[model samples]
Target: MSAGLLVAVLLASALLEGSGWAGGVGDGNLRLSVTVNGRADSDVRPPEVRVGTWVVKRYRLLNVSEADLHRVRVLDPGAPAGSVRCPAVLPAAEEAECTARFRAVAGRHVHPVRAEGDVPALRTRLTATARAGYAGVAGALGLTEEVVVATPGTGGGGASAIVTYTVTNRGNLPLYTVRVEDPGLALAPGAPDCGGRGGTVAVLAPDTSAFCRTTVRLRPGTYRSAGRASGSDRATTLGTGGERVTAPVLTAGASAVFVVREAPVAPVPRTPAPGAPAAGSSAGAAGASAGAGAAPAPGAPGALARTDTGTGTGTGTGTDAAGRPAAPAAPGAGAAPGAVPPGAVPPGAVPPSSVSPGAVPPAPPPGLRRAAGVDDEGFLGRVRRRGREAAEFGVATTLLLLLIPAAVAAALLGSRRK
Candidate 1:
């Protein structure tokens, strides 16, 4: 091999051995030079030396400038990237400082290896968030909600309004099943369905979403609605949200609340039988006549308001007993906080308060230890050792810094004569 090629091979071999990559390094030697700002700092320095099975290069640096030279990095292009920190602070008239060099490491296998101290030209960063919820689907294939409302109909008891519920998974993580907790909400044909199998979704993977619907029955008075879910029949409540004036859930855990209201039936107007007066016919007529007798007599329920025995619906704009549009019902509990009033859960109703306020995850693993580090310098300027490597590598690298400038000079001077 040519001098350059031989030098490369020897250096590579020495490194592998030193790193324990090889069992032993046979004797080998080759030399190279060092330059800083175009000035040759080290004359023919040993370019490559095999200690065992690996190769390495030894060179030095002499910071003779007036200012404190700070590059905090080893200028190695063919190495696993490394950093260099000058401790001597190169005082204006101080002698040269020193450092040595090694060839490379397996880190080169990683794409665009930055190898510490060696800053890369390109860098990237990322962030993410995750949440698990009841209404959300996990890996489910086909589950759906079918809102079915039963209400007071146009003339009698029936569906007053058609409320559609669309349950969906809009966050990361999957949900296996969405239990029915709302008193009135329910999953049709067996908890809606995920594919053909009901229960939770099969896989509500990250970024995956599913939608289901359920109908709600509404009545005259204001009522709240809320529900809780469970993964299994015995599982405690997993999540909760709902509205007010709602009925208590039948079961303690994973039950839904539905509301039912019946308009007070009014007594119908009665005309006396053609020949015989009905039981209260005479009394009813007398009361009406008496109320009109004076300026609608001081009091008496707006003239006993002929209680319309008919189903009394707040006509048109659905107003209230006072003829005012019932102020929109407070949002139901857990209905998208802030948007819907929380549904009321009886004292012993909601799933036994599933989660406690204070809970924390476990600590990290050994492999996830903090990066190798140095601690606060003490009063004497001695760096506090972080761990084992700090003690060994820290000292070795320090000595190399001290020997750099001298070895470099000797190597160059010796080379000139050759």
Candidate 2:
């Protein structure tokens, strides 16, 4: 062949090799096809999807040549690693499939899928590519609101309550300019903290929540309050110029019921009741009168004059009929001190003038003795008498012990001297 003709032939052969068609005779080849959202690429229109929705991509690979394909791989940039499922080896004249998934975003999206394999019999590589397209639209706007109230305990005047509002985005799109409002109550200062700048929650993403808290004063009664949350799908301001756009507002509401009670009162104390005179004064007056008027029976105790009945004359010196000094009266007895009643002085009784004023009174006759601890000497007086006697006995015993030792020493000295 001529040199010019040979150059042209070589150029044609290079192009065929670069295009994977040089050794097309009996060499293995792969055909790749892709679908987006279950719609094939040859369809007239692409699949329409909502933003944040799942976009499913399917890849089909066919071994068109007479030889089997080995070490096959399917790759998609939009899908995560190990998410594309495909067989490692594909038989001749057979088809293999792969599936991958990704989330859709606002605007049109194009995804390219690639299939590659090794042809061992021909010692060559085969590659094929296909693309799928989908269009994304704006999602629905939705919201949910919840209100919680913390009521105060019993208090004076009206007490403050802590009100919390929880707003949640329940749809696939983000919400903007979220705010809470209550018509029946006024919020306190430095309140409505929604974890945003200036106590406002500007945005809430899909399926997420934001909390706002405020304070309000409530009286002592049952209160029912409702709170509404409103948000829009687009931001109110678009650019640096502060241009405002009107968007559809979505609202949700919830109500809370709570009660506040009143404080309790204290009680007052009572006064005591009235009654009688003391025993000492009545007994002394009765004793003086009875000493002059009557005497008790010989072996019987005297009956006390009734002071409450006003029957006795409470006057006169405390002396017996024979002019002897009287014995002291017992408390509450009201009897004459030492006077004997008419038949009380026995026939042979001693004369009063014979006994001195300071002399001790005679003991009662045999069967009329007083009980133990009931003597005329008071309990404190008896205690004093016993204490003096104990002191004297102790002193005498100590002197005797000293004298006995001295006597024994003196006796020993005298014996030695003799």
Candidate 3:
């Protein structure tokens, strides 16, 4: 063969292989058998299906060829055909099986499926059918409210009350104009959807939903509100659709209690105006006696100094050597020069008069003197006493524990004698 002819043959073979056709097209070669729910011609057809329900179709591929089959695949009507279960290589006199699954669409319709593959050098094709039906559109709506009371001192800004309503398409068919309505809030005219697009949705798939949010400024009181949703069910015949059937209006409501309290008041500090005279001075005193004046500014040194100076004026108390006011003395009281005050003793000094009548006094030659009624042994004596007490407690505890068994034995003996 010429080189060009050989290349043409190779291209044809590649196309056939890519298409996954294995056996010859005519009968007496590879055969194809299709079944729906395991019955080719049954009294009952496949049951009706809603959106999202599965429509299952099984396919069996048998190889009449004496050699193994390769490049085998099952093709269905829809893109991404469901799942296939078959061995790559089909030995002679044996068969391989696969399943094609289709998810129900929004309306009644028929879906066609087929399989094609190459056994060895020949091409083969098999066919099957699947049907899906819808049960009309129905829906349910629910509304919920979330309320948060503002904390004291946090006057405003955050959302205090929020109402959310969900519109769900519970029917088998797709829905249109899915929107929520609220008596308390301003919704878009002609029923506005949650997306706030101001236009109806072309299609809301079955078992799906949309959420509408409305916010309100809640005062310090209880709140109650109601909302509802509306939508139109889609109707389709054959391959055409878009006919709308009005669905029943769904109503829901929510109630929330929002509370707010008055903010707290903080005391303001008083500041003396600039050029104002110092407090508690003659000017401050004059201002006070006039029945109109602010109190002395707190923590001012001048105010404290004025108060201390005022304590000595017009009083009979004399000033001490330290310049502090002295305590008043009795009428006949007299003191020698450099003498300490009565009833006051120098620290760590012993007074002669404080000694007991018959106690022997220490000689003056010794710098240190022994005090009466002082315990010489002191801390050591206390420690020895504590140690003796601890030993007695240990002995008592040991005796008690040792006598318990003896007491029990004696009780048994007494009972036996009885």
What shift in Å separates residue 398 of candidate 2 from its native position after superposition?
Answer: 5.5
Task: Name the lDDT value of residue 64 in candidate 2.
Answer: 82
TM-score of 3: 0.29
For candidate 1, write residues 235-328 as lDDT tens digits. 1211111111121112212222334556445568777667775685888778868967774311222422122222233341245666655443
Backbone clashes, candidate 1: 81
| Candidate 3 backbone collisions, by pair | 20-117, 20-118, 21-117, 21-118, 22-117, 22-118, 22-119, 22-122
Per-candidate TM equals 0.23, 0.37, 0.29
User: Model 2, which residues run further than 4 Å from truth?
Assistant: 1-130, 133-158, 168-175, 183-199, 203-210, 235-247, 250-252, 265-388, 397-418
Measured on C-alpha atoms, candidate 2 has an lDDT of 0.64
TM-score rank, highest first?
A: 2, 3, 1
User: What does each candidate score in C-alpha RMSD?
Assistant: 56.8, 15.1, 29.8
The 10 consecutive residues of candidate 1 with the worst lDDT sum are 110-119
lDDT of 2 by residue, 239-339 (tens): 11223334456778877777756543334554434544445568876877787587543334445442222222243225565556455433333445444
Worst 10 residues of 2 by lDDT: 235-244
Best by lDDT: 2
lDDT of 1: 0.34
- Which scores higher on lDDT, 1 or 2? 2
Give the poorly placed runs of model 3, Cα more than 4 Å off.
1-28, 33-47, 53-55, 64-68, 79-82, 101-109, 121-418
